[model samples]
Structures are given as structure tokens and as C-alpha cells.
Target: MTPQMRHRLVHAGWLAAALAALGGVFVLYVHPDFLVTLVDQVWSCF
Candidate 1:
């Protein structure tokens, strides 16, 4: 692939990752119980 195409693909990948991160944050904010459960599970693993 061309350099320009590769650059565009890299940029798109970063954007997609950022949006997914933001979505996950929103979900956690809306349902804090999920976060609590996750923490509990992790603590149990120790």
C-alpha cells in the first residue's frame, strides 16, 4: 500500500480505538455496578 494510504489507515485505527474507549467510559459511568463487580472479581483473584 502507498504511504498516504498507510497513514490514513493508522489514523482511522487510532480514532476507532479512542471512540471505543470513550464508549466504555460512558457505559461504566451509567452503570457503576458493573465497575464494582469487576473490581470485586479482580480482588478475589488475588
Candidate 2:
């Protein structure tokens, strides 16, 4: 890949990871029950 393409991809990956981390923080601090619901949904698929 070109240098510019590689740079863009790396930046995008970092942004996605940062957004995911922020979401986790919000869920932990603002809505702790989100985790419980998430687990329940996941288990329900079984």
C-alpha cells in the first residue's frame, strides 16, 4: 500500500479503538446495567 493509504488506515484503526474505549467508559460510568443486558442478550442466542 501507499504511504498515505497506510497512514489513513492506521489513523482509522486508532479512531475506532478510541471510540470503543469511550463507549465502554460511558457504559461503565453512566449505565452499568448495559453490561448486564449485553450479557443476557449474548446468552439468549445460545
Instruction: Report, for every candidate in turn, its global Cα lDDT versus the true structure.
Output: 0.99, 0.93
lDDT of 2 by residue, 1-46 (tens): 9999999999999999999999889878798688789899999999
Pick out the ten consecutive residues of candidate 2 with the lowest summed lDDT. 26-35
**What does candidate 1's lDDT look like per residue over 1-46, in tens digits?**
9999999999999999999999999999999999999999999999
* TM-score of model number 1: 0.87
Alpha-carbon RMSD, each predicted model? 1.0, 3.5
Off by over 4 Å in 1: none
- Which pairs clash inside model 2? none
Task: Please provide TM-scores, in order, for all candidate models, with all chains considered together.
Answer: 0.87, 0.63
Clashes of each: 0, 0
lDDT of candidate 2 at residue 30, scale 0 to 100: 90
Scored against the true structure, residue 4 in model 2 reaches a CA lDDT of: 100
